[model samples]
Target: MSSASTVAKKKQTPQNTLSLHYLGDRVLRQPTKRISKINQSVRDLAQEMVQTMYAEQGIGLAAPQVGVNKQMLVIDCDPNNTATPPLVLINPEIQTYSPELATGEEGCLSIPGVYLDVVRPEAVQVKFRDESGRPQKMKASGLLARVIQHELDHLHGVLFVDRVRNDLVLTEALNKQGFSAKAVQPIKS
Candidate 1:
């Protein structure tokens, strides 16, 4: 292997750990910029995001959630398995989605303890760049699909709470969790 490749691989430790930006923070609302290049720095950030996700016991997280306004996210549905690696998506785009919709209980690391019911497509096809900067595409379903859609929303400055159909329940849950309901920018379907 090339020395550069070896160096990049060795730098994959969790040293660049970032703090989460909570709801009501303008950083979370600002749209993320597309990554022009996936270099070592970007890879390190992804590694740190993975560490933070595991530390927070979250299945998914976005760059904006970590106060980074870049189109990136990390997800690992099965955190218990060390053999399965976390998926790092850079400049991800949902190419298509299944017409069939399903409701799933969703939550955000940014919002902390608040969870709400969200309706989304049962399946999705997404295109993105891998950590190695290679173009990649895949179809996702079940928990993986739900987490992808949720994390992708963060790139567009959207939150899962925005998709909640019941305002009262959402507001109650947010309030109970010490979060403000006003922070949610609900998308009217």
Candidate 2:
């Protein structure tokens, strides 16, 4: 098998489909605990998360979304291509961010069909441990930066909708998706 095929097989999640915990789920509001050690179980969990993300056609996913209260997240900016690879971050923390801010349409697998514009730093320097427990740091920009920030918010019990500036549009979008606009904990820019 080719390397890409090997990767696909390796990244596959659990046997049963991973169910996404929706926006109103209390699990989504609880802050995730930092992972102290990475092991086979953690690796397995991350694999399951990657599979769930791909199955849901999402670019990023957090441990909270899958009912796991751990600081873990998976991201693949180019999810359309298997060759692009994916990142599994455990206990990720942003060290610094660029002064430049950019607004982009953001969505969550947990929130399902709701999409809203959120403004965030265009670039970031982050530190985290890989799936194998190896410490790593990265400078991320563009879609990668957005995805990292978005998923990081999940680790802190913050949803993208909370960061949306326009309350009118946000309420309309969430209500249309059958989510209560009251659930949003807006953060002023």
Please name the candidate that would achieve the greatest lDDT relative to the true structure.
Answer: 2
TM-score each candidate.
0.91, 0.92
Candidate 1 accuracy as lDDT: 0.84
Give the per-residue lDDT digits (tens) of candidate 2, residues 128-168: 88876778888999999999999999999999999988889
Point out where model 2 deviates above 4 Å: 1-16
Clash totals, every prediction: 0, 1
Instruction: Give the C-alpha miss distance for residue 18 in model 1, angstroms.
Output: 1.2
Query: What TM value does model 2 have?
Result: 0.92
Query: Please, what is the whole-model Cα lDDT of each candidate in the order they appear?
Result: 0.84, 0.84
Candidate 1: clashing pairs of residues = none
Residue 31 in candidate 1 has what lDDT?
92
